[model samples]
Target: MKQVLVLGAHGQIAQIVTKNLLAEDVQQKLFLRSSARLTVANPQKEKLIEGNALSLFDLQQAMEGVDIVYANLAGNVVESAKNVIAAMKAKGVKRLIWISTLGIYDEVPGEYGKWNHEQLDGGYLETYAEAAQLIEDSDLDYTIIRPAWLDNQDEVSYELTRKGEAFKGTEVSRKSIADLVTKIIGEPSLYVRESLGVNKPNTDGNKPAWYR
Candidate 1:
C-alpha cells in the first residue's frame, strides 16, 4: 500500500482529500502546524504529525517512511515548495502532487486573463508561479495542479488544459480537485512531470460566474 503524507492537511481541499483517503487502503500521515487543529473522528487510523511545512526538521519528521507527498500548502509557497523538495529528497520519496492556481501561467484568456493578472499579479499569482518553477525543476516525479477559482459545489465534474494552452472556464468545485487528487494517488504514473489546468466544462465566461 502507498504510504501518503499530506502537508497542509487542514485546508478545505486537503480536508476533502483526507476524508477520501480514509476509504482507500493506504496509510496516511497528516502534517499540520498544530495538532490541536485536527478534528477528524477515528483519527487514530491515520498518523497525525504536527510540524511546519517550511521547517526542514518538521518536514523531514513528517515525511518519514512515506511514499507519496500531497502538498496542499500555501503562504510563502515558493519557500514552502523548496523546503518540501529538500525534505522529500532527503527521505528519497519520489512523487509529489502540488496545488497551484491557473492565473500563475497567465493562461486565462482575453478579458479574464487581464483581470486575473490585475487582481493577483503581485500576490498569489507571483508566488504560485515561482513555486511551480521550483517543482518543475526538481528531479522528483511531480504533477502540479492548477485549478480555476474554487467553489464548494458537491459534484466532481471538471476538465483540463495541458501546459501552454489557454486555461478554460472560470471556476471549479473543490470536490472536483479532491477527486482528481484521489485519482492521481491511485495511479501515480498519470501526468508525471506535468502541470495541468483544471476547470468545470463549459463554464467559460468573461470572468467567474459569481463575478457577474
Candidate 2:
C-alpha cells in the first residue's frame, strides 16, 4: 500500500480526495496548516498532521515515509512549491500531483484565452507558471494538473489535453479533478512527468456558462 501525503488538505478537492481514498487500500497523511479543520474518520487509513507548506522543515517532517505527494495549494505557491520539492528530495519521495490553474501556459486559445488573461493576468497566472516551471525542472516524477474554471457540481465528467495543445472547454467539475487524482493514485504510472489540462467536454464558450 502506498503511503500518500496530502498537502493543503483543507481544500475542497483534497477533502473530496480524502473521502475517495478512504474506500481504497492506500494510507493517507493529510497535512494542513490547522489540522483541526479536518477530522480523521479512519484511524488506520488516515492521519491528520498540522504543517505549513512554506516551512521546509514542516514539510520534511510531514513527508517522512510517504510515497506520493498530492499538493492542492494556493497563495504564495512558488515558495510552497520550492519547499515541497526540497522536502520531497530530503525524504527521498517522488511522484507529485500538483494542482494549478489553467491559462498558466497561455494554452487556452481564442476569445476565451483573452478573457482568461483578463481574469488571471498580472499575478495569479504568472506565479502559478513559475511554480509549475520549478516543478518541471525538478527530477521527480511530477504531473501538473491545470484545471479549467471549476464548479461544485456533483458530476465527474472531464477531458484532458496535454501540454502544447490548445485547452478544451471552459469549465469542469471539481469532482472530476478529484476523480482524476484518485485514478492517478490508483495507478501511479499514469501520466508521469507530464502536464495535463483538464476540462469538461463540449462546454467551449467565450466564458464559462455561469459566467455568461
Candidate 3:
C-alpha cells in the first residue's frame, strides 16, 4: 500500500478527498499550515503534518515516504508550485495531482468565457496559469485538474476536456472533483502528465447559476 501526501489538507476539497481516501488502502500524510484544527479519523492510518507549501524544508518533511502527492492549495500558487516541484525532486516523489481553476488557458468559450474572465481575471487567473506552466514544464508525472465554478452539491457529475480543446459546461460539484482525485489515487496511471478541464455535463451558461 502506497502512502499519499495531501498538501493543503485544510481546504474543503482536500478534506473531502482525505475522508474518501481514509476508507481505502492508502495511508495519508495530511500536510497543512496548522495541523491541530484537523481531527485525524484513523490515528494509525493518517498522519497530520504541520507545514506550509511555500517552505521547501516543510514540504520535504511531508514528502518523506509519500508515493503520490495530491495538492489542493490556494494563495501564491506560483511559489507553491516551485516549492512543490523542488521538494518532490528532493524526495524523489513522481506523481502529482494539482487543483487549479478554469480559464487558465483561455479555453472557456462564449458568454461564459467572458463571465469567467470578469470573475477570475487580473491576478487570480494569471498566477494560476503561471503555476500550471511550471508543473507542465517539470519532469514529474503530474495531472493538473482544472475544475469549473465549484459548489457544495453532493453529487459527482463531470466531463473532461483536454488541454487544447475548449472547456465545457459551467458549474460542477466539489464532490465531482474530489471523486476524480479519488479515482486517480486509486490508479495512478489514469491521467499522467495531462491537464484536464472538469465540468458538469449540461451546465452551459453565462456564469454559474448562483451568480446568474
Candidate 4:
C-alpha cells in the first residue's frame, strides 16, 4: 500500500485528490499551514499535519513514513519545490507528483499564447517555470502536470500533451486534474520523468472561454 503525502491539502484540486485517495484505501498524510483551511469532511481521520512547505523541518516531519509526495501548492512554488526535493531526499521518498501550469513553458499556440504570456509572464509563469525546471532536474522520480485554466466543473475528462508538444485546448476541470493525480498515484511508473500538459478537448480558443 502506498502512503501518499499531499502538500497544500486544502487547495481545490488537492481536496478532490484526497477524497479519491480515501476511496482507494491508500494511506494519506495531509500537510497544510493551518487546520482551519481543511474543509474536507473527517479531516481528523487522516494524518493531518500543520506546517509550511517552505520549511524543511516541517516538511521533514510530515514526510516521515510517506511513500509519495503530491504537491498541489501555490505561492513561491519554486522555493516550495526545492524544499520538497531536499526533504524527499532526506526521507528517501522517491516519487513526486507536481502541479504546474501550461503557460510556464510557452506551450500554448496562436492568440492564446499572447494572452497566457501577458497574464502570467511576470508572476505565475516565471515562478512555475523555475519550479518545473528544478523538479525535472532533480534525481527524484517526478511527473510535472501542467493543467490549463482550472474550472470547478464536476466532470472528469481531459487531454494530454507530452513534453515539447504544443498544448491542446483550454479550461480543464479541477476534477479532471484530480483524476489524473489519482491515476498517477496508483501507477507510479506511469509518466515518470515526464511533463504533461492537460486541457479540455475541443475547447480551444484565444484564452480560456471563461476569460472572455
Candidate 5:
C-alpha cells in the first residue's frame, strides 16, 4: 500500500478527499494545522497527523515515510506552494497533486469570466496562478488539477481539458474534485507535469449549463 500524505485536510475539497481516502484500503496520513478544527470522525485514527501546512517543521514531520503528497492547501498559494515544494524536496517526496482553479489561465472568455478576473485581480487565484507557474518550472513530478466554480453537489462526473482550453462549464461538485484527486493518487503517470482544467460538459450557448 502506498503511504500518502494530504495537506489542507480541513477544507471542503480536502474533507471529501479525506473521506474517500479513509474508505480506501491504503495507508493514508492526513496533515492538518489543528485537530480541534476537524469535526469529522475517523474510525481509523492512526492514519491522521495534525500539522500546519505553512510550517516547515510541520511539513517536514508529515513528509517522513510518505510516498506521495496531496497538497490542497489554501491562502497565499504562491508562498504555500513554495514551502510545500521545499518540504517535499527535503524529504525526497517525488509526487505532488496540487489543487488550483480554472480562471488562472484567463481562457474563460465571457462576462462571468471577466467578472471572475476582476474579482481576483489581487487575490488568491492570482497567487494560485503564480504557484502553478512555479510548479510548471519545477523538477518535481506534479499534476495540477484546476477545477471551475466548485459546488456542493453529490455527483462525481466531469470532463477535463489541457491548459489554454476553455473549461466551457462551471460549478463542478466538490465530490467530483475529490474523485479526481483520488484518481491522480492512484494513477500519477497519466497526467504528470500537466495542468488540466476540469468541469462538466457544456450543453447550451457553447458553455456548460452549470456556468449559466
Candidate 6:
C-alpha cells in the first residue's frame, strides 16, 4: 500500500479527500494541528498525526516513509508551502499534490472575478500565487490543482483547464475536488509540474455563465 501524508486534514476539501483515499484502500497519514474536532469514526483504517502545517519538524515526522504528499493548507500559503517543500526535501519525497485556489493567475474574469479579488484582498491570493511559483521552481514532481469557488453541495464532477486558459466556471463541490485529488494520487504522471484549474462547466451566457 502507498503511504500518503495529507496536510491540513481538518478542512472541508481535505476531509473529503481523506474519505476518498480510505475508500481506495490507501494508507493515509493525516497531519493536523488539532484532531479533536476531526470526527473520523473509523480509526482503524486511517492514521492521524497531530501537527501544525507551519512546523517543519512536525511535518518531517509525519512524512516519514510516505510515498506521496497532498497539501491542502490555507492561510500564509507561501510560508506553509516552504515548510512542505523543506520537509519533502529532507525526506527525499518527490511527488506533491497542492490545493490552490483559482484567480491566482487572474484567469477568472468579470464581475465574479471582481468579487473574488475583494474576497481575497490584502495579498492573500498573492501569497498562494507565490506558493505556486515556488512549486514550479522546485525540483519535486508537483501537480498544482487550482479549483474554482468551493461549494459543499453534491458529488464529484467538474472540468479542468491548463495554464493560460481561463477557468470558466464557479463553485465546484468539495467532493469533486476530493475526487480529483484521489485521481491524481492514483495517476501521478498525468499532471506532473502542471498547474490546472478545475471548475464545473457553464452552459449559459456569452462567456462562461458560472464565472459571472
Candidates in order have lDDT scores of 0.90, 0.96, 0.95, 0.90, 0.79, 0.84
Clashes of each: 0, 0, 0, 0, 1, 0
Tell how far residue 117 is off in model 6, in angstroms.
1.8
Worst 10 residues of 3 by lDDT: 203-212
Q: Candidate 3, after superposition: displacement of residue 195 in Å?
A: 0.3
Q: lDDT tens digits, residues 1-212, model 1?
A: 77999999989999999899888877888889987898765555587888898899999988888999999998989889999999999999989999999887777899888887887887789999999999999999999999988999899999989899999998999999999999999889999999999999998887788864
Which digits, one per residue and each the tens of the lDDT, describe model 3 over residues 78-111? Answer: 9999999999999999999999999999999999
Q: lDDT: which candidate is best?
A: 2
- In model 5, state the lDDT of residue 145: 90
RMSD of each: 1.1, 0.7, 0.7, 1.4, 2.4, 2.4
Residue 85 shift from truth in candidate 5, angstroms: 0.6
158-184 per-residue lDDT for model 4 (tens digits): 989998899899789999999999999
Assess every candidate by TM-score. Answer: 0.97, 0.99, 0.99, 0.96, 0.89, 0.91
lDDT (Cα, tens digit) per residue for candidate 6, span 9-110: 898888888877777757888888887767764676688889988888999999999989999998778989999999999999999999998888998777
Q: Alpha-carbon error at 150 in model 6, in Å?
A: 1.0
Residue 150, candidate 1: Cα error in Å is 0.5
Misplaced by over 4 Å in model 6 are 203-212
Ranking by lDDT: 2, 3, 4, 1, 6, 5
lDDT of 6: 0.84
